[model samples]
Target: MIKDRFSDDDDGLQPLAYNMSHDEGNAANTETLHLNVLEDVHIFTTQFELTHKLNVIQKAALLLQSDTSLDDAPGLSVHEITALANETTHKWQQPWTMYLTIVVTALGAIGQGWAQTSMNGANLYFPDAFGIGSGSARDNFTVGLINSGIYLSNGLLGAWLVAPLNNAFGRRGAVFAAALVSLLSNIGGALTQNWQQLLFFRLILGCALGVISSTLNIFAAECAPAVIRGGLAVSWQMFCAFGIFVGFIANVAVYDFGSNAWRLQLAAPFLSTIPLLILIYVCPESPAWYIKNNDHYDRAFLSLCRLRNTEIQAARELYQAYLQQSTKHDSKDKLTYFKTLTELFTIPRVRRATVAAHTVMISQQLCGINTTAFYSSTIFLDANFSKYSALLASVAFGFINFVGAFPAVWTMDTLGRRSLLLLTLPLMALTMLAIGLSFSIPADSPAHFGLLAAMIYLFCAEYSPGLGPVPAAYSAEVFPLSHREIGTSSAVAVTSLWASALSLTFPTLLNTLGSQGSFTLYAALNVVAFVLVFLLVPETRMKTLDELDEVFAVPTRSFIKYQLTVYIPWWMKRYVLRRDKVELPPVEGWRTEEYQAVCQNEE
Candidate 1:
C-alpha cells in the first residue's frame, strides 16, 4: 500500500525534472531527476525569496535561512547547502578582502598612469623639458607611438596572458606578478634616456598592467557574495580615483624638478605597497579554486569562513554548497592549458558570451571614454588654466567617476542588465555632443563655457558606471558556469585589443579629427549601440545564471505558453516543451493546493 502511494508522488515532479535528468532514455524515475524540484517549490512558496531572483541559489538560501543548525538543515550534506545559500541569501560583510583588493588594484593602476602622465604633461611645465622634434607630424608620431605600445600590450598580450596567469599563479599570484613587473617598469621608465626606450618599456609595462586589469574583475566576483558583487567590483574605480588623487599631488609637488618631475611621477605608482601588503596577508584565494583542485574541501571551507569572518563548521556547510555549484559551473574536464584554449572556441554559449563581452568593451573604448580621461589634463591646459589647476581637475575626474559608479553598482541587482546598458547610450551621446560642440567654438572662447568641458568629463564619469563596468561584469557572467574562466579571458582579450587600439590611435585621432570631429563620430556610434541594446540585449539584473540561461537559450521566434500565449522571441521563451516527449497528466486542480500533501507523502 505504501509502495503504491510513493509511486503517485513521483508523478508530481516529473515535468520540470526532464532537462535535469542525464538521459532522455530514462523515462523511469524522472521524479528523482531534478533533485531540486521539491527544494525549489518550498523556497519560492516562502516570502523571503526575492521576487526577482527565483533560481537554485535563492531556493537554497531560503532553505538554509529557515534551518537553524547544519544537522537540522533540511538537506543531506550541510556543507554544500550552506555555502551556496550564504552567497545568495545570507549577506555577510567583510572589508578585509574587498577594501584591500580595491586599494591594491587602484595603486597598481597609478603605477601605470605614471608611465604616461607627467611625460605627456611635459607640454606644460618644461615646454622643452622633453621636446617633440618636428612640427605637428613629429609631435603626433611621438604621441601616437607611445599610445601604440599601451594598446598592444594591453590589447594583444594582456588578453592572452590573463587566463594562463590566473590559472597558474592564482589571483594573488597574478597581482603579485603585476606588482613586481610594475616595480621594475617604473624604475626603468624613470631611468630611461631616449623616447624609444621609454616607449618600449612603457608598452612592456602596459602589457603587464593589462593582465591585472583583465583578471581583477573576475577575482572580485568569485570572492564576493552575489548581493555585494557590484559594490565590491566598483572598488576598482575608487582605487583608480585615489591613484589620480595621488598623481595630481605628486605631479604638482615635483613640477619644479623640471625633467626630474617626470621620474618622480613615474615611480609614484609603486607606492601602492601599503594596500598591496594587506591584500597579500589577509585576502583569501577564491573558494571556487579550492574545489577546482579536488579534495581540498576543508581548506576551501576555512578560506570562506576567514574571508567572511563566520564560524568554521557553519561556514563549512555553506562552502560545500558553494563547491557543488562551482563544480557544476567549473568542471575539471582535464583542465589542461590547451584544453582551456580549445573549449573557449568550441562552446557555443562560451563563444557568444565572449563576443558580447568583447563588443561591450570595444564600444566603451571606441566611445572615447579613455581618450577623454587621458587628455583631460590637456583640455584643461587648453582652457588656459594653470598646470596645477589642470592637475587638480584631473584628480577631480577620478572622484566624479568614483561617485558615478555607485549608482550603477547599486542598481545592477535591482535594475535589469538590458535597461542599464540601453539607458547608457542616450545619456552618454548627449554628453559627448556637448563636449564636441564646446570644442567647435573659437580658441578665444571664454572659460565660462567650460561647462561643456565639464560635460565631457561628466561623460567619462557616466561611462564607467554604465558602459565602463558592463563589459567586465558581462564577461564574468555571460557563459555557462562550466567554462566561465576561459570564456571570460577570451572576452577580455578582445577588449584588451580594443584598449590597445584606443591608446594607440586616440592621440593621433584626436590630433587629426580634432576634439569636435572625434567626439561627434563616437556620438554617432552611440546611436547604433542604443538600437542594439533595444533589439538584442535582455535584462540580467536581479536574476541568476540559470535564469539567464533559461531566458536566453530559447529561440527568439514564436513561443506558445498555455492560453496567455504572448508572442516572444525564440530567445525569450522561459520554458521548453519537448513535443516529441511524453507529458504527465495535469496536476489537475490540486497542483497548487496539493503540493504540501504530495511532498509530505513522498517524505
Candidate 2:
C-alpha cells in the first residue's frame, strides 16, 4: 500500500496488524500493559499501570460503540477532528448521494404532506353554496385538530419505531418502509368518507414520516463518509421544509379548482415519489451499516469510495473506525432497548448533552413553527385574503424555511452553536410579538387593515434563518455517540409532546381567545424560551463529540464555563478525556472465549 506511507509527513505514527483472535492470545493479554507518553507524549516508564488489555481493533471499535461523546481522543486537536468530520460527513449530500436520501425521504414525506392538506377544505373557506356559511367557534376547533394531528403523531411513534426498525432493517429498508406506508396511507386519507377516517390516516402518516425523518438523518450521517454530513443532513431537513411547502401549494391549487378540495389535497404527496423512487434503485446503502453488520467489506468499501469521492486508501481512517465498531458488536453485550436508554442518562456527558439538545428543540416548537405551518392558511383567510391568496401566503412560510437552512449550513462550523442560538432566539421572539401586535385592531374598526398577511410572511421567513435549522442540528449533535440514539430520541420526544399538544389544542384555544390571545401567547413563550437558551445552551460547533464530554462531563453554569472547567481546572474531565487512561466501561466479566455468548444472552 504505497510503500508504507506518511514518509513525507514525519508524524511518528505506526500501523500494526489489527487482529486479536489467535492461539497466542493469552501471551498477548499479559503483554497488554500499554506504554504512555506521560504529560505530553514523553516516554514515562513510571506512570505505566496494569489494565485490561484490548487489541487495536477493539480500541477502535470502541469509537463506534462508545457514546456520541467525541470530547477526547489521542493525537488530534478538537477543531481538527470536528473539521475533518464535518468535511467527510457532509459529502453524503452531494448530488449523487443526496438524490438517494431525498428519494428515500419522499417515502416518509408522502404521508406527512398529504396529512397537512386533509383539513384545508373545512378549515380555510366556509361553503358559499346553499345554506353553507363561515365556521363558528366549534368548526375552527374541529378543523384545527385535523391540521395539527400529523406533527403530534410523528413524535409519539418516531421514538417507538424508527430506532428499532433502523437497527433491524438497515437505514435503506427503514426509509423504504416509510415511503410504502406513505403511499398507502395518503391514498387512504384521500378516500376517507368522514373526519375519523381522515384522522386515522393522519396518525398513520405521522408514524410513517417519523420513521423516515429519524432514520434518514442517521442514514444521511452514515451514507456520508466525513466531509459533507452537515450540508446533507440539513438538506434532509430542508426537504421537510418543502414538504410543508408542498402541503401549502396543494391547498391553494385545490381551492382554485375544486370545491371539496380536501380530497384532492390528501393525494398530493404521493406524486412526489415519481422521481424519488427511481433514485432509490441506484442509491447505495450506509457503508458503515453494511460493513459493520453484514460483513460485506468489498461492497461497503466501494460504497465508501463513491460516498467520499476518494480512493479507498485515503479512507483508511473511516475504515478503521468501522472495524472498531464491528469488534464491539462481536465482543460486547447486546444493546437492548431499555438498557440503551439507561446508559444514555446514566452517563455524565451524554445526559448533559441530552438536556441541552432537548431544550433547544422544545424551544423551537415553542417558537411556533407548527402553529405557523399548520394554521397560517387559516390565519390568512381570517385576515381577508382571497380564496387562493391564503394558500400562497402559507406556501411562503415553507419557502422561507427551506431557504433559511442555507445560512446555518454555511456557518455551522465557522460561527459555532451558542453564537447562532443567542443571535436567533431574541429576534424570533421579537418578530413573533410583532406579528401578534399587527392583528390587534377590532374587527369592526377602520384599523382592521391587511397587515396580518405581511406580518406573517415576515415572521415565518425571518425566524427561519436562525431557529428553523438550529434546534434540529443542536438536538442531533449535542449527544454523545454512545447515547446518540436514546438521548436525541428523548429530546425529540419532548419537542414532539409540545408540538402535538399545541397542534391538537391550538384551534380551540384560538377560537376561545381570539387570534390576538393565541398569537400573544405564542409570542410570550418565545420570550421565555429565548431567555432559557441564552443562559443554558453551549457553543458546540467545531468541537469533537468526545471533547464535549471533557467540556460538559460535569454540570456547569454555561457551556463556556463547562469548556473552561473541563480543560483548565484540575484535569476535571479526566474520565471522558482519558478514556484509554481510565478503566473500561463495565462489560460482562467473563473469559475472552465467552464474549459472544454473553452478548447472545442479551440478544
Candidate 3:
C-alpha cells in the first residue's frame, strides 16, 4: 500500500523535483528518492511553508532511511527539521573574486580615455605638419573633418558593430577584440607619414574606443553586487579621466622632442591597451549574459558563484531571482536587429529611459567639455600663453579632471545621481559664465589669463564629479538585461554624434564667435541642461537595475516630485547637512499605496 501511494505521489512531485534539480545539482536516482519522501511531507503542510518544510523533512528522512537498523523511517522531529531548514538557507559572504573582476574590467577605461585625449595636445602641431594653414576656409574645413572623423565613425559605425559582436563573442571577447584593434590602430598612427594615414588610423582607433566604451560599463555593472554596482561601473569613467591625465602628461613630456613628438603622443594609448588585454584574459564572462543570451544555465550559475562569493546553492537562488525579473519581457524567439531597435523605442519605460539617456549623453557633449578638452591648448594659446605654457596648462586641467573624478567614487551611491548633477550643473554654468567674462577682458591682462585657467580647471572639476561619470553609469543601469546592449550602444552613438558635431564646429565657432562668445554660448547650453535634468532625470543611486526599471515606469510628474522634494532633501539632510539636531519633515504622497502599486504593476 505504501509503495503504491509513493508511486502515485511521484507523478505530482515530478515537476518540483525537476525545478529543484535544475537549480541544485544532484544524482538522478538519489534525487528522485529524496524528492518522493519530501513530497509526502509537503502534501500535509500549509501552502506557505510547503517547500521549506519539504526540504527540512526530506533531509532528516534521508538520514533515517539510510540506516538499515531503522525498522521504518523515523517520524519527523520539528526541532531537527527547523535546524536543517535554517542551515539550507544560510548565506555565505561574497568572495574577493568579485572585487578582482571589477578592478580588472575597469582597466579598459584607461585605454578609452587615452584614445580620446591623445589628439588633444597633439593637435597644436598638426596644422603645420599636415600643411593645413590655420586661417583658410578649405584648410580649416579639412582640419575639422580630420578632428571630428573619429566621432563620426563612432556614431555611424563603431557602436553598431559592437552589438552583434557582443551578442556573438561575449563581453570579454568584445573587449579583447577592441583592445587588439586599439593596439594596431595606435601603432599605425605612430608610423603614419602623412595626414591621410593619421586620419585613417584615428578613425579606426575611434571604432575600437566606441566598442570599449559601450561594453566595459555594462560588463562591470552586470558583474558587480547591487550595493556597489554604480561605484564600480562609474570607475570606468574615473579611469578614463586618469588616462586623459596621463595623456596630457605624456604630451607635456614629449613637447620638447621636436617634430616626432606628436607621433609618440599618438602611440601612447597602446600602452594602456596592453594591460587591458592581459586583464580580459584573466576575467570571467558576465554570468547574466551567459544565462540570458546563451542559455548556458550551469555555466551561468558557476560564474555567479564566483562573482557573488557565495556557494552554488546561494548563487543559484540569486540567479533564479534575476532570471524571474529579466524573463518577464523575454520572448522565446530570437530578437532580430530591427526588432531590438524598435522595441527600445516602443516599450514605455524603456523608451522613457532611452530618451533620458540620450538627453544625458547629448548634454555631455553639448555642454562643452569636449571643446574644452580637445582645444584646451588652443584656447590657452588664443589667450596669449606660449606653446609650452598652453601644453602645460592642458596637463594641469587633465590633472584636475582626474582628481575631481575620485570624489564621485565615494559619493555616487551615498549622495545619489540626481543630487550630484543638481549640485554640479549650476556651478558648471556659473563657471562657464565666469570663463566667458574673463575672456572678454584684454588678452594681455594678468587677470584675464589667470581667471581663464582657473575657470577651466573649475569646469573640469565640476564636470568629472557629476556630468562626466553619472550619465554613463545611469545609462548602463537603466536598461533591462535584454535591451542593455542595444540601448547602451544607442546612447554611445548619440554621444558620438554630438561629440562629432561639437568637434567639427569648434574651430569654426571659435573663429566666428571668439573665446568669449563661444563660452557664453556654452554657458547657455549648460543652463538648458540643468533645467532638463531637474525636470526629467531620476535618482538611481542604491537601487538595483530591476528597481530602477520600476522607478522609471511610474508617471513623470510623481517621480520628479518624489526625487526633488522627498528624496533629495532627505539625502541632503543626512549627508550634506551633517547636523545632529536638524531633521527635515517628510513629504506627503511620496510613497503612497497608489504609487507603490503602480511601480509594482509595471515591474
Candidate 3 structure quality by residue, lDDT tens digits, 194-213: 78888898889888888888
Query: TM-score of every model?
Result: 0.73, 0.73, 0.79
What is model 3's C-alpha RMSD?
Answer: 9.1
Candidate with maximal lDDT:
3
Question: In model 1, which regions exceed 4 Å deviation?
Answer: 1-92, 95-135, 312-335, 383-386, 447-449, 555-603
lDDT of 3 at 231: 57
**Candidate 2 per-residue lDDT over residues 482-544, each given as its tens digit:** 566666667766777788788768777877877877888888998888767765676676766
Error of 2 at 517 (Å): 1.4
lDDT of 3 at 125: 80
Candidate 1, residue 99: the lDDT equals 50
Give candidate 1's whole-model lDDT.
0.58
Give one digit per residue, the lDDT tens place, for model 1 in 1-603: 011111122222321222333334544544352345445533432433222222332223323443234443332234454554565565544547555655555666555544445444443532234566342766766765664566667666766787778777877788778767766776787677767777877777877777776667666666666567756655655555445556666777776775567667766666664456356546777666665555454455556665563343334444345535644645465567778678666554454455455567666666776666666676677666677777777767656765676676676666645567777788898888777777766757674347665886678677767886566676677777666766776776676576666655666677788767877887887776765555444455665776766444422221112112232222234335434343332222223444445434433
